[model samples]
Target: MSTTALPDIRAARDERVVGALALALAASLVVQNAAVAWAAAPSYAAPMTEVLAFHAEHRGAVAIAVGLEALNLPLLLGFLAGLRGLVEQRGGAGAVWSRLALAAGAVLSAAFGLYAVLWIGTVLVADGLTGPTPLLELVWQLHAAAFAFVLSALGTTLVAAALTTHAGRLTAPWQRWLGLVGGGLMLAAGAASLPIADGSSLLFVGMPGYAAWLVWLLATGVRLVRRAA
Candidate 1:
């Protein structure tokens, strides 16, 4: 290929990466939501025993959902790489914001990955465990704490990405607004979880925030796919 053709090939490859990342993220969201909702898994607010019982009975479904979520880890990394390249191409504050988004996404992905593993561990032992529900409760609290950090990082990633895209005229005005709102909601959810011991605190806004994020992921994925096409 000629020198001129190389850039086109590179650009196409990058677009494909973004498209692939979008699909992975969308699939992860769908599977995670379906597994939890269909299995009727207990929320963190539920009693320890209730939560344990649900998991004990529906371990297979829970595992499948979380497995799908785990599949997003690599896709998230790909997204960061694609965003970084876009930022470098655009230059200016877009560059800085993209770095921020990349950093935030990296840590967010790690945190979420760990959160999934932790839940898997808890579910595995839920059925055969003896007394001392407090022990498991403490473990659950720690899991929620990790999730809070994860959400906070996700919020930062979304906001920075939105700013970068908007500045570069890469996305629609409404999409940018959605990013801002979605980011704020995720941040609020993280904040609501400050009292780690009281999972009920997350009921107010935290859950809704994550639900919005799920929607955002789906929409963002579709947009990326269309852009690639």
Candidate 2:
């Protein structure tokens, strides 16, 4: 094979690997959400007694969800890193945005890890106790606050990644718009973290935004894989 052919082969491999990472990240997210939904976890606003009871009764389900989340964090980081590489390889025009995406994704992953730990801690404490304790409630509230931060970080990552990919001509215009809208909503909700942690319903605004991000991820992954093929 000619020397020039090696670069082409490497580029194709990178595309496929990045595409697979995106797909896997999206799938992991879907599984995490499904597990959470199956767990029927209570909202932050639920009464302490009810929250404790739910945790006590659904420890296994909650554990499963947290475990899936732990798996998700690394997938998210891998996808972000791969995405940055893709953008850089495409002439590095969007290097700034790619760097921002990677940084935000790192923070998002860390925040999510904290949230998962807090959640599991609450479950463990609740499981051993017959009633809700002040400490358990405090831990749960901290978990909610961590999730609020995660939303903001996710918003940053989505917007930056969208911009980077679009600037690199790696994604469609519609996908960029979707990311902007979704990221905007998530930022809005996350800006009200204090209220959200206090059990405000305003957090609902971020839910659809998160869904949009997921759709964008899945679409982008498919597009990359097809192009590589």
TM-score of each: 0.87, 0.96
Best by lDDT: 2
TM-score of 1: 0.87
Model 1 lDDT, full chain set: 0.73
lDDT of 1 by residue, 115-213 (tens): 887787677667687643765777676677777877788888888878777776556777678788878878877776657436656534655656666
lDDT of 1 at 200: 56
Candidates in order have lDDT scores of 0.73, 0.88
What RMSD does model 2 have? 1.1
Model 2 ranges off by over 4 Å: none
Clashing pairs in 2: none
